[model samples]
Target chain A: MSIVVTYNKLVEFGDCDPARIVWFPNYFKWIDAASRNYFTQRGVPPWHATEREFGILGTPVVDTHAQFTNTASYGDVLSIHTRITQWRKTSFVMHYEVMRDHCSIMTCIETRVFAKHVGNTPDSSHHQIKAIPVPEFIKQLCGFSQ
Target chain B: MSIVVTYNKLVEFGDCDPARIVWFPNYFKWIDAASRNYFTQRGVPPWHATEREFGILGTPVVDTHAQFTNTASYGDVLSIHTRITQWRKTSFVMHYEVMRDHCSIMTCIETRVFAKHVGNTPDSSHHQIKAIPVPEFIKQLCGFSQ
Candidate 1:
């Protein structure tokens, strides 16, 4: 299933550089927040909660790439669109397109992995926690595949 | 000389949530750009330039920590104050504070380390490139020790 999230954003002055453009790194931050919101809105809660409940650890960024197509200033309204592109046994990927006034500002792709929660134990075996198959119930809502 | 770069920005609509708070991660992105601008203002140019011209490598983030004190919403004016906190032989630290309405909203500390640039060589030696010394000229401008 494809999930589309739209919101209007005002660029804060601190988000730009001397070149008067939104810093490249800021785009990732915006999309990350949006992704978290998207999951929460879908009743899955944050990834941190998923880890705690299932003892499955969410891997930090393994790979990330972005392409800047346009410039944004400190007061421009930006709209962000994010969708899951791929899912695997232990990993998934997401693609994001950020736009302003019908023009694409940036696009990003990110991949992440999962493992057993390594919270307190340092010598824990590196076994892959079973991937939580997309529940059929939620799949109906999200139109996602199992 | 201490150079100040001011950027005009508009808060993107996605920067705020239902509660109208600017998400936290965006603060780091702002400071990241400011720090890069700081280096450029200091004549180092972008890290990419240093890699090409001086055979110096771009530093990678080793660690980062931040404290959130206040909330900024969409369209708020935010000013970021960034400066070098410490410069060691092979590494440096930067401190950033984000402000809105003259009140601090967040503070961040980031540490990074540099190595010699090695093009297309994964195992290339970086031992030969000594740590870059802080020039006396910059010392006078920033009024800090190396």
Candidate 2:
């Protein structure tokens, strides 16, 4: 079983739109950060470590959904609670809740894949990424005893 | 009948992540700009215009979902096609399709409400926002007739 982690952030002035409320997209950014923090909390090394260990890049989001319950503004402090809800062969689902004290500001779920740079395209050397089966080592590190 | 609007954009180098792909959140940012462009193209005044005319602040997103179909990198030119697929009494849905040349890169659907500032709270003048019925004039301006 994976453990839940909390990532704290201060809403910056630039995070808000002309409406003075935090732009919705910023929530996704923070959620992505929180997702990384989840791995960090699990004692998983950063993505850079994989180039040497597993020849992997980083996970990429394939789908996401977010629902806003309350509004937030600059100068406000927010906490994002994150956890891996489910893990598939090559992809996993992350659940996140952004809160301000007792207020549940937003909730989100994302599907991300364990990706690797397969090779450069024939037309160009642009690296192509594809989902690979989750490694047993990485899974064990995240407390998934598979 | 609402006409679709296309917003052309250049993916800047700063928008890419360490993975060399455009960070996902930047897509939301462009989608937002495209949303506003839809209104601008429809001859609707900016949200600030509503302060005196209707006391409305702006649209606040209630829910949103997006799916990334392909990876995009810096120096890529993309176009977002946006349209209002449905308009309810108090909220409307915006559908966005992002394209690179002939490839469909991503798609999103957002539900948003017309918002306004209410009175200050007993503790402070902290502005409270609430949703109001979609104004008929605003709908008409978008080519949705009563």
Winner by TM-score:
2
What would the per-residue lDDT of candidate 1 be over residues A1-146, giving only the tens digit for each residue?
Answer: 57776645778889765444565567766777766665557776455565567644443334455555556777688888877777665556777788987988877676645434323356632222333444343334445755
Q: Tell me the alpha-carbon RMSD of every candidate.
A: 14.7, 1.7
Q: What is the C-alpha local distance difference test score of each model? A: 0.59, 0.88
Tell me how far the alpha carbon of residue B74 in candidate 2 is from the true structure, in angstroms, after superposition: 1.0
Name model 2 segments beyond 4 Å from true. Answer: A122-125
lDDT digits (tens) for residues A62-115 of candidate 2 = 999999999898888999999888889889999999998889999999999988
Candidate 1: misplaced stretches above 4 Å? A56-59, A119-141, B1-146
Candidate 1 lDDT over B1-146, as tens digits, reads 33344433445668654333564455656766777666666666565666677655544444455565555667677887777778665567777777776777777677655545223356632122334544344444545543
Between which residue pairs do clashes occur in model 2? Answer: none
- Indicate the residue-level lDDT of A135 in model 2: 74
Model 2 chain B worst lDDT run, 10 consecutive residues = B119-128
